[model samples]
Target: MRLIIAEKHSVGQAIAQAVGGHMEKHDGYVQVGDDLVTWAQGHLVDLAAPDEYKDHDWDRWSLDTLPIDPTPDWQWKVSRDKGADRQYKVVAGLMRRGDVDMLVDACDPDREGEAIFRRIVKHAGVSKPMRRLWVASLEEDAIRDALASMKDETEYQGLADSAMIRAKADWLIGMNASRAYSLVYNARFTVGRVQTPTLAMIVDRDRQIAGHVARPYWKVVAPMGGWKLAGERLDKREDAETLLRIVNSDDFAFSIFKAERKQQHDAPPRLYDLTGLQKDMSRLHGLTAARTLSALQSLYEKKLATYPRTDSQYITHDDLDTLRGLTEGDRLAAGFIEPDAKPERPHLELTVNDAKVAGHTAILPTMQADKAALDELGDDERLVLTRVVRRMWEAVGDDYVHDVTNVVANIDPHWCEKHPDEGRLLPEGECRFTSRSDQPVSLGWHAIEHAAPQEDHGEEDEAAGNIIPANLAAGVSIAPVPHGGATLSEGKTKPPKPFTEATLLAAMEHASRWVEDKDLKAALDDDESHSGGIGTPATRADVIEKLIRTGYVERKGKQLRSTEQGRSLIDVVAPKLKDVAVF
Candidate 1:
């Protein structure tokens, strides 16, 4: 007989179904034919509390008991949740059952999941032969495939160790620093391994915004047929007027000095990692990162999507067959995919590399989601699922091909009146102007609206010029028209917008700038860095939510702003704890 332990009851049920187990339900567990299947509500066991350490005053939150450390014999206990302890007893009882000979660690396939299973087995003191079931999707075929290919549990010791270190580090910092700072300041300063530093980033940005000063500027533009070209921005108002007057004169002449047209292929976006999905959800639906994660998690549990906690945005080369089927595999996705849409060799190669993948491939829709089922989901859930499905098709899409034309001109006020007969004109010095535009050779992925269009404001955006057709070539002289009407328009600089959860998460992810030291910044920015981005992908949502729960951050609409209380804590907190570099 075999014993199967899953991360949760729903997953346990899925595993049992895939294995063709007999139905026999019991308290905290169920029996399936020759196997005993059980589930844990996340982690049934965790590190013991400070009070659990004998002969220590760490239980009290006082200055004397600041740095709590239960070293050497670090204690472990069933978590405080009533269900956890009750379920732990149930699993422990089954672990000793004479009928069961082999143990299967069927938890979520990630570092945290490894930790969860190891802690349970260790606490129960089970010494049976153990195996692992690593599944990227909960779909029946995927589960059965995983069960058939289970590996020895010892293979995952490295992952389990990583989780252990992460958990212990979090406990040490959250326990010690929170107590030390709170006692020193005589206020409840809820410091976190990730939360405090994240809060510090927002506070720093606010200070920069508060001190920002806006300056004024001017520019001159000329219209030729449909195209509009802008002159350089002039610091003085008189300089802009001089250029405008020169262009306004009928005698003014200019020649297109450089006219170049180049075509390039634009590649499609990669598949959605958790962070990338959170960003798009925030951008498209105004959904917070936490809300998006919650929706995606629900989809995963329902077998409509793959695992949601992954960091990789690429799939392995081996998953190509399944990845191909996913394109038009289910009826719901068929409607969104182009009829001829299939990922080409080049496209597949771009998104498939075995080396970088960890835990799971990027989030994607499963074949189980049909039209009716997809429609039954909430609007946000449907939106997320549709995006994943579309991205699968898009990731393999043909490149977006287009041509960019850059036309440069040199204008001379006196040359037009004197050299009316001349077709080719002067050297590079006088008021230089340039016009640029892109022409599409093929719509490719853009035809399906695979991604939203983001506007680009180049240097010539000063006067909001139009994209001129690629008509005028080098040495071609054209008379200036007033259609783009010259103006010395003045505008003030603007402060950076406050953080929305989307931008805040991005800041955390790409936070190479949070610190000055190159090595330290590189470490923080690394996905596998000890304290990357203030928090890991699994915990960042909760970190943001915790800030709001504790009033360290407040929601002003979709934007996150540090509250006065939160700001005050940063103000009085010790320099090292709050320091961007040291922290």
Candidate 2:
């Protein structure tokens, strides 16, 4: 008999169905014809926690165990997740069967996936010849294809080694730092390769904001037609009042302002990776990053989208044909050519870069989706799938076209002088100018309607307002109309915003530059090094949520702020241990 072990029950069931395995209900196993199929609920076993050691008085948190290194003899235990013990018993029983010939690791094709299978098999003491079933999508056809092309487990030894190192490193840091800080600071403080730096980032931002001091500033305003033309004034309010008097005193002649048209192309947005999806969901629908991830996971399980926990926003050459076919008849597909459309010279430039992608391809629609099926999904799940489907169409769609225009006008002092109090303008000697742009054109992907803005907006909206219009040539003049007492604006130069889940994810993705050391960033970016700047996609969210739950980080509304307990922990931990580079 051949034994197949899957990372989770759903995947195992999918593979069993694809491989012509007849399902039968058994005590601890799913008897699939001659194959004994068993599943792990994520991880069936994990390294025992510090309190579980039960040996020394060190069960309580203390700084003495600064770095809890897991020795070769370190104990392991079954995970506390319900059904883990039963699943393990089933797997062990299947392994003990006399007719079993070999074992198949039909897990998700990633590092953590590799760790899940290895830990289970090692704990179960199974020594059978092992083959790996590495497939990206859970589609039945994909599973069958993977089973037909199974590779020897030895081929993934490096991946397994890397996964083991990551798990052990997390265990070392989380256990030691958590205990050390909890004891010293008298707070439940947890830290890890990913979480500590993220918390530190939030704390630093809060400090910068607290130290910021506001300064008063003045601006000139000219109302022309229905639009208001605004410009900044010097620091002195007296200077602005004098200018306002002069402009109001005269009626300025209007000249035709310069008008020039230029074509601009905005490439359609790249396909969604987990982080990108999370950011969009947060910005558009007020979905928390964790909530968005949950919806994406559901979509993946339903086969509506590709794997959702991936970091890559580009697909390989092999997936191009399927991608093209999936979007062929859709409304957005009218402008996009299929991959085979240009057969001899495929235009794969859209998502074909080999250097950028790893583990899995971008989030995309699987061939299994139908418009009617989407109606059955919950609101959040439907929203996530809609994003995936829209992104797929947009990725290959035409570039967004825009006609940008910059209009600048000189302020007339006489007009300002005529309505001194009404027109808040700079003095005649002070330089003044105003600029405006026509409404933006939405040519392609930008045409997709996003949800209307919520009543409560944030800094992101202010930043979006700062997009500059096209350049304006000098010497354009326009008529100035009386301004009705617009209040001058003032603000302090603000510090960076604290890391919301959205921003923290961005920081992790770009963690290479967190350290000023050039060599460290280079090493992290290099493909040869096992540790990328960010933690693995599968574990990054967990790391973040853990920090929040353990009081190392606190979420205030949408902002993530670090606690005093979190700061003290960082000060105590070895610098390298807190850095993501150590991973």
Candidate 3:
């Protein structure tokens, strides 16, 4: 008998369906054709914690065990989670069967996915001819194709080795560092390879916000018809009033000394990767990053979407026809595409850089782009699916078009970078006052945004207030009404805004910015490096959620702030452990 073991139950079901086998449901598996198919709930086994080690010294919490490394004889056991033991027994039983000819690793196609399958097989102590079934998409055709081309598991040795090393390294850092800090502070401070650096970033930002003291400043605005032009800010009110008086004089005229008008275009947003989707979910629906991942996991399990853990925002050439058909068939999304929108050369060519794709393509809908499928989803799942569908349509759609204009008024070119008398003498001349305005030439891909069930960008555009009539030209003299909404205004300098979940996720993703050394920065910023960032996309949400769970961080509205305990941990923790650059 040929036995197939998938990473999850839903995947197992999909495989059975794709192969068209009669079903005989068994203990923790099902039978289709002559194949007995089973699933493991994520990982059935994990490396034993420090307490489970043989020596009592390890069990004791002290400074002597500052760094723990797993030896060659390190132990593994069934996870303590509820159903792990039961599922482990079932999978092991199936693998040990006399009739089973070979074992198939039908797990996820990434490093962590490789780790999940290998650990289970090793723990069960079942040796057989191992085959790999790697599928990027869960569509019936894709699954059948993957099965027909299954390769020996030996091909993934490098990926498995990398995954093992990462898991052990994280365990060593977390186990020793957490205990050392916890003992030193007399509190169970959870320290980790990624979580520490991520928490430090938030704490540093909070310090800046706390240290800030607001200062006052002044600005002058001139109202002309429907448009408003603001002069540069002045340190004092007298300086602002002096400029206001000059402009308020009877003979003074507003002339645009410089003007530029050009056509501008915006391509649709890149497709959803795990991090991008998490950021959008946090901002739009107030869902935590962990919650968003969980929702996406459900979608992936039901085969409604492609793999959710992929980092690549690009697809390969093989996915072109699948994506183009999806856009054409989706009724709600079809209108977003232009009548002339053909999946022709350049536009379809944009998403097909083979060098950028790895493991899996971008998150996309399977046959589930069908409008009828969305009816059974919950509200949060519904929102996520809607966005996924909308993004697909937008990716291949036309570029949005805009007409932009820049108007500069009351110019004196020599005033800037010109101090004629060696920083001392004569009268300083008036300076240029500039403003920008944009007119929408065409909606293009953005035409469907109004009809999609997506969130509005929470803030109005900063430059939206400056738009003017199309007929306004350079060198035209316009009368100024300085009294209405355009009078002199005074305000206080504000502190930097706190870090919200969406912004925090972005910071964590681009964690290379936290370090300054050129070589180290390169190491972190290289997206190709599997372990480049502080945490993997698969684990970043958990790292963030763990910080909150352990009292190292707290949520205020949408902002994530360091608590008193969290702040003190940073203050007292050893620099080598908490330092973002080194850690």
Candidate 4:
């Protein structure tokens, strides 16, 4: 008999259903025709704590036990999380079953999933022939297909090695640095490889906002008949007045030196990876990353969505047919699409890039979503499901088309040279003004976005020049209007906005942008898995939550700011410890 171990109970249940047997359910496991299926509650086994090592007295948090390196002699312990130990025993017992000859690692298809299965096997001291069950969806067909074409567990040894190395590295850094800092400061301080750098980013941004100095400037705004022309910025009010006067003067001759309009097409957005979904949820729904993840996880278990922890934003060519099916029929009408809504012919291939999709495809609504009573889902789940479903249609929708017009007018050189303030405020050359406008021809994919509910960020309106007259032709003479012409608009340069959850997630995902060392930045860029980031899409939200839980970062409304303690921690940590490139 073969034993299949899954990452969670729901996954194991789904696998058992796909396996198709009598399905005799037991405590912590299920009995299929000729196989046993079980699960681990997250990490059933973890790194042994420092105090657990018999070779050292590291239990007493002291500076002497500074570098807690359990190198070649690393130890493992069962997790104390509720029910983890019990579940581990059940899985271990099944592994040693007399009839079982082979084991299947049916964990989530990712690096962390590999680590979870390996740790459980090692801690249980079981060495049976193993196979890997890798699938992105929990749907019956997907699971059965993955089961029939399993690969030898040894084929994934390299992935397992990398996972182990990352776990140990995190342990070493977190244990030693957290203890050393806590001892010196006489307080409990928790440090992590990725979490520290993440905190540093927040602290740095806060400092920038606190120390920022605003500068004032002025611009000349002239109201044409149906358009507005903006002049170059001037440092002094006198200079602005001189240019404003030149444009408004009776002798001033206004003529369009250039006017051009070009058609542009904006492609639809790519599908959501986990981080992208979390970011959008945080922005539009005011949901935290953890909350978004939890809701998605629930949806995945219910077989309404595909995998929720993936980082890839693309679907493989193999999923093209599935994508096509989703766009047709009543699949999206469950709760998101209106009956009268006429979606465009979806360009299904737009999001298909096999090379970009790694272990799993981007999150998609399962066909089951169509039959599910989505209204019964929790508010958060419904909100996320709606977003996912809407994005499904939008991802394959038509491109947005718009006509952009740019116009530039030059002030007659004779008038500039003849002005009273000739060489003073006015430059030697001809004074020029510019205008731009965009006329959207097709809403396209944006139509779907517009149909969904959006959070009012209270964003300011577009500049006046964004809608100038399209009829203005090159070399056309113009006369300035009476009121609101030649207006001197004073503005102040604003400081950087505080980090919202959405922006912070973006920063963490693209951490290489924060690195100064070229070599290190290049290395990060070349990393295929992380793609120049400190944490995976799976762990970043947790890191942020940990910082908040520890009182290091505080959330004021939607903005995240480092508290006094958080800033002080960043200040005290050594440069190497907080460096983004190093981690």
Candidate 5:
């Protein structure tokens, strides 16, 4: 008999159903044929509290208990989360069952999932033969396939070690620093290895926005027959007027110095990892990372999508056939997908990389979703599912092809001579103007993006400029229209925008750029999964939510601003704690 342990009750039920038998439901487990399935409500067993350590007075929030290092002799306890204790007992009871000769670790396929199962087994003090059931989707077929091809649990020991080290490091930093800082300030202050650096970034950006000073500048633009050319930005209005007068004159003619056209192809974007999905949802629908994650989890449980917590943006070689089917038929039947929009010559290879897909495949819609009624899903779930479906089709799309034309010209010599003072102000006695435009050769992947125009929020249309004439080539001279005189446009430099969840998520993902040390930055960037970020995709949302929950950060509409308390914490935090690399 086998005992299958899942990460949650919904997942447990899915596994039980996939096991194929009349399931006998119990208090917290289900008996299916000769096998039993159980679950943990997240981390049912976690590191013990500081006070639980008998050797230290770590319970008292004092500076003396500054560093809570519980290494080598670390203790474990049942999580205080609701019903965690009861669930632990149920799982432990099953592990001790005499008939259950084999154990199956069927938790979510990730580092945290590995840690969850290991902690429980160790806490229960039971030795049994163990196997791992790793599946990316909760669909019945996928689950059954996983059950039939289980691997020995020992294969994932490296992943478990990494998870444990990360957990302990977080615990030591959070416990020690939070207590030390809170005791020093006489107020409750929570600090974390990842959360502190993330908070520091917000606080720094807020400071930058607050301290910004806008500078004014002017530019001269001349209208040609079909297109407009712009002069360089001038620091002084008088300098701009010099160029303006030269272009406004009827005698003004352009000597085309350089005109070049080249064809360019924009490759389609890769598939959505969890972070990428969260960022897009925040940008497109104004959904929080936590909300997007929650919706994705629901979709995963419904077997409409694959696992939700993956960091990889590509699938393995084994998943290519499944991906091909997803690209065809109604597998991705979200209402947002246009009926005519199909990948006739899908580039499935663009989304395949065996080495990159460490555990779970990229977030994808399952075949089961093709027949499921999507409208029956909750509002957020439906919205999230729509995005996932759209992205799947978009990932395999052809390249967007376009021809870009760049032209640079100089005002006629006669005009410069007509206004000698203005000519002298110009660089090398010539006023230069430049214009660029892109003409679409093929819409390709852009067709999908264009079909769902509402999905793009902040993206600027590259092809929105005027059409450049084919005859306007190098060495050609054209007179400026007498009707449209050159004019000076004045504008002020805009301050950087505040951090929205989308931009903030991006900043967190590429945080290696913030580090000054070359070696440290390289070290951070070396890990493909992290991509130089402080936290994993699985933990980043929780870190953001924790910051908000603790009143360190506040959401003002879509913008995330560091609160007064948050800034204060950053201000008082030890310099090393605020460093991204130090974490």
Candidate 6:
């Protein structure tokens, strides 16, 4: 008999179905064939809190307990999750059974996933033969594939080590800093590896906004028939007024300046990764990051989409055939017609780059998805899945096309005779104009539309327009218009916007920028060796939520802001921990 331990109940059930195990209800597991399918509801055990140690001095918060480093003899406590204690006992009982030959840690394929299994097994004192059942998706096919190709547990020792380091570092920081700050300021505060840096980003942005100052400037405008020409005045408003007086002399003659036209292309957008999907859902549908993730996970469970919690924007070469099948006969493939002679080779390159991927491939649609099944999903879930399917089709489809044009003019000084003080220089019919056209071109992947009003912009402007009008050589001239009005507008500089979950996630992923060692920062991004970065995708969201719950950070609309207590805690920490280094 083999005991398969899963990260959660849903995952265990999926694995059991894949392995063709019979259903027998035990206290905390479902028996199938010779396998005992059981799961941990996240984590069955966590480090004991200070007060749980039964020390009166540690019962109340104090700065004196500055750095509470737990020794090997430190106690472990059962997790507070509703049914964890019972679940742990069930797992232990299975491990102790004489017939069980080996144990399988079938958790999510990430660092935290390793931590979940290791903690449970360590606490249960099970030393049986062990292996890892690493599957990127919860789909039965994916699970079966993983089981058939199971790797030895030792293969992931580095991952386990990294996971342990992250957990201990977080424990050290969160326990010590939280207690220290809460005691000093008489407020509840929490800090950790990911959350503290995140809070610092928000506080800094707030300070930048508070300190910003505004200045005034002016510009000059000339109108010619249907077109308008504008130029900035020197820094002083008086200089602009003086120029207006000179140009109003009625003897000034305008000369042809310059005209140029250039062709431009806007490629279609890249496929969605977890962060990209979250940002799009938030911007388009007003869904929170947590809600978007939940919907995506549901889509994956139903076998309609690939893995959801991924950072990679590229797929493996092995997935090409599956991708090709999705693009054939799909509703999203409607407008694309395969070439008659040799279907133009699909542009699989954009989604197939091997070097940039980490952990798993980009979020995509599985070939098994049925369009009719969409009716069974809730409104938001259906919307998000539809987006995923559409993106997959677009990624492999043709590029978008566009053409551009530019026009320029020169005006006579006599045009400004009536407005000496206003800087209005062009008369009704005294301006020369020129026009030119550049060739039309394709924008590649950026042309594929992801949502309705296909050309809509996202919050961060990842693919904002950069089209330049066609150029007409410097001396070209055309018909001119007689008169136009000129006016100056005034505005002040604004502060940086607060961190949204989307922006904050990006900051955390790039947190190594704050480190000083180039080598350490490089190592942080070395996915093949380390676990990508400081926190795994499965744990980052929880880290963020913990920060909010502990009052170290607060949400203002969609933006995150650091509270007063959070700011003071950073000041109290040693400079090495707080400073932004290259590592």
Query: Best candidate, TM-score-wise?
Result: 5
Model 6: lDDT of residue 31: 87
Ranking by lDDT: 5, 4, 1, 3, 2, 6
How far is 39's C-alpha from truth in model 2 (Å)?
0.3
Q: What tens-digit string does per-residue lDDT give for candidate 6 at 248-348? A: 33444344466544446454467888877876776666676777888988887777787787878778888777677766554444332222311245576
In model 4, which regions exceed 4 Å deviation? 338-342, 417-424, 428-432, 451-466, 526-532
Q: For candidate 4, which ten residues in a row score worst on lDDT?
A: 456-465
Off by over 4 Å in 1: 328-332, 335-347, 413-430, 450-465, 520-534, 574-583
lDDT of 1 by residue, 332-386 (tens): 4455555544443425666797776876898878878767777799988888887
Poorly placed runs, candidate 6 (over 4 Å): 54-57, 224-228, 241-260, 331-345, 403-471, 477-482, 512-536, 564-574, 580-583
Error of 4 at 95 (Å): 0.9
Full-model lDDT for every candidate: 0.78, 0.68, 0.77, 0.84, 0.85, 0.66
Best by lDDT: 5
Question: What are the per-residue Cα lDDT tens digits for candidate 2 across 1-583?
Answer: 8899887777777777877855896765587778877788888889888778777545655566556665776777898888888788887778777899899988778888898888888888878899999877778888888889999999999889988877787787777766776677676666676777766666667777777675555665555545544555457777655554544435552232454556678886788888888877776676777788888877777767778877788888878787767755553223222322222321345866556677688888787776666778898987877777767666665666776554545454354456555455433335454444444565555555323354344422222222333343444445554434333434333456667777777777667867777888888777445354676666667777888788778888877787877777777766776665654
Q: Pairs clashing in candidate 4?
A: none
Per-residue lDDT of candidate 5, residues 474-559 (tens digit): 98878766544777878777667889999888888888878999987887777464554778889889999999999999999999
Span of ten consecutive residues with least summed lDDT in model 3: 419-428
Which ranges in model 3 have alpha carbons more than 4 Å from their true place? 332-346, 411-430, 450-462, 469-486, 530-532
- Candidate 4 achieves a global lDDT of 0.84
In candidate 1, where is summed lDDT lowest over 10 consecutive residues?
421-430
Tens digits of lDDT, candidate 3, 322-345 = 776665543534432343443332
lDDT of model 6 at position 209: 73
Better of 3 and 6 by TM-score: 3
TM-score of each: 0.90, 0.84, 0.91, 0.94, 0.95, 0.82
- The true-versus-predicted C-alpha distance at residue 291 of model 3, in Å, is 1.8
